[model samples]
Target: MVSAAYRRVNGGHDLAESNIVIYTHPTCEICVTVKMELDEQGKAYEEIDLAEFPERWSEVEELADGDRITPVTVENGEVTIGYHGIGCMFYD
Candidate 1:
C-alpha cells in the first residue's frame, strides 16, 4: 500500500500505467533540457503548452500556490513548479 499523499499523486505518476503532464514551452531552455533527459531515458509524457491552454494555467497556479510556475511537470497527480534541479526522477 502507498501513503495517502502518494496515492493522491499516483506515486508521482511514476507508475507504468500513469500518465505524466508536462507544461512546457518549446523555447524554454529548462524544458528542453528536461525533455532531452526524458527522451534519453525513454520516458513517456504528454505536453500541454501553457500558451495554448490558458485555462490549465489556473490549475497549475492552484497546485503551485500561485508561484511563478512554468514548465510545470506533473506525474500522475503530483505537481512540480519548475525544472531546475528537479526532473522526472522525482516521479521515478
Candidate 2:
C-alpha cells in the first residue's frame, strides 16, 4: 500500500506565497519527519494524507517514477526519495 500528495505552487518560498504540497500518511514516520523539518525551517507546506485519500497512491508512484516510496519531496520536477538522498535538497 502506497500513498502520496500533489503540491500546486504559485511562488517558491513561503506557504503564503507558494503552495508546497507533501503526499503523506499517518503511518509514515518519514512523512512526519518531513513535515517537522519544513515546520522547523519556517517553510509552509500543504500535506496530502494518503491514509485519507487512498486513491492518490498512483500519484506517489508517478512522482517516484514507479517506486512506492512515501514522503517524496518534489520541487521544480526534482525528486528526492527517502531521507538524506541525493539530488533533492528539501532538507537543506
Candidate 3:
C-alpha cells in the first residue's frame, strides 16, 4: 500500500512546499539509518514500503538506470537514490 500523508501550509494546498516521498524496503539497514537522520532533523517525509506493493516496481524501474536499490528520495522534481547523509543536506 503506497499511502501518503502530508500537511498543508499557509492554509492552502501547495505541493511545492510540502512534497517529500521516500521509497524503501523493510529490511534495508541503509534505509533505517537514513530515516533516523530525517527524524533527528525533524523532517516530514512519507515512506513507501515496496515490499507491500510489488506493482510499484515499475515506478522504481523507471528511475533505475541499471542497478536496483531502495530508499529513493524525491523532493520537488529532483530525485536522490540510495541512502547517504550527504544528500540529506539538500533537505535543508
Q: Identify the leading candidate in terms of lDDT.
A: 2
State the displacement of the C-alpha of residue 46, model 1, in Å, after optimal TM-score superposition: 0.3
How far in Å is the alpha carbon of 30 misplaced in model 2?
A: 1.2
Give one digit per residue, the lDDT tens place, for model 1 in 43-78.
667666655655565666677766545678777677
lDDT of 2: 0.61
Q: How accurate is candidate 3 locally (lDDT)?
A: 0.59
Q: Tell me the whole-model lDDT of each prediction, alpha carbons only.
A: 0.57, 0.61, 0.59
C-alpha RMSD for every candidate: 10.6, 9.2, 9.0
How does residue 80 of candidate 1 score in lDDT? 69
Off by over 4 Å in 1: 1-18, 85-92
Error of 1 at 20 (Å): 0.9
Instruction: Please provide, for model 3 over 1-92, each residue's C-alpha lDDT reduced to its tens digit, 9 standing for 90 to 100.
Output: 21133331232224453467666767777777766776667677666666666556556556655435776777776887886533211110
TM-score quality measure for candidate 1: 0.63
**Residue range with the least summed lDDT across 10 consecutive positions in model 3:** 1-10
lDDT of 2 by residue, 1-92 (tens): 11223243322233444346676767777877787777677765666666677666677788877766678775555666766762221210
Deviation of model 2 at 54, angstroms: 1.0
Candidate order (TM-score): 3, 2, 1
